[model samples]
Target: MAKYSEKASEKVEESMHETKEGKLKSGSGKKVTSKKQAIAIGLSEARKEGAKVPKKKD
Candidate 1:
């Protein structure tokens, strides 16, 4: 598995928790229900925050 920075992991964990609680939303204002989507969102946020995360796959 790829190593994630502590901040990145924390963001992902928080996203997962929000997803499980049905409180995660998408950019289009839709509710997020998929695990993958939540993780993606978390990574996106981490990127925005300048966290040490890998580049997005092509």
Candidate 2:
């Protein structure tokens, strides 16, 4: 199993929450409707924040 930092997990959780509440949006300002997409957004943010997240796959 891959290890994600606490901060990364927290960001993921927050994004998931936003998705559940119908408040998550994509870069184009469209409402996010997929759980996977939400997770991706969270991870991307964590990466920007310098969290212990793995590098994205090509």
Candidate 3:
């Protein structure tokens, strides 16, 4: 099992909401439509904030 900090979890939740509302966008200026992409964005944001998120799997 992987462990995520509370802050990271909250960021994921926030990103999910933005995705559902059609407000989330990718680095290429494309609107995000996939749930997996949204989650990735959230984790990326959490990482930027120094949240305790595990490194991406290869």
The most accurate candidate by lDDT is 2
Q: TM-score of every model?
A: 0.94, 0.97, 0.95
Candidate 3 residue spans exceeding 4 A from truth = none
Give the per-residue lDDT of model 3 (tens digit) for 1-58: 8899999999999999999999999999999999999999999999999999999989
Tens-digit lDDT track of model 2 for 10-43: 9999999999999999999999999999999999
Each model's Cα RMSD: 0.7, 0.5, 0.6
lDDT of each: 0.96, 0.97, 0.97
Candidate 2, backbone clash total: 0
Candidate 1: clashing pairs of residues? none
Model 1 TM-score? Answer: 0.94
- What's the ranking of the predictions by lDDT, best on top? 2, 3, 1
lDDT of 2: 0.97
lDDT of 1: 0.96
Which parts of model 2 are misplaced by more than 4 Å? none
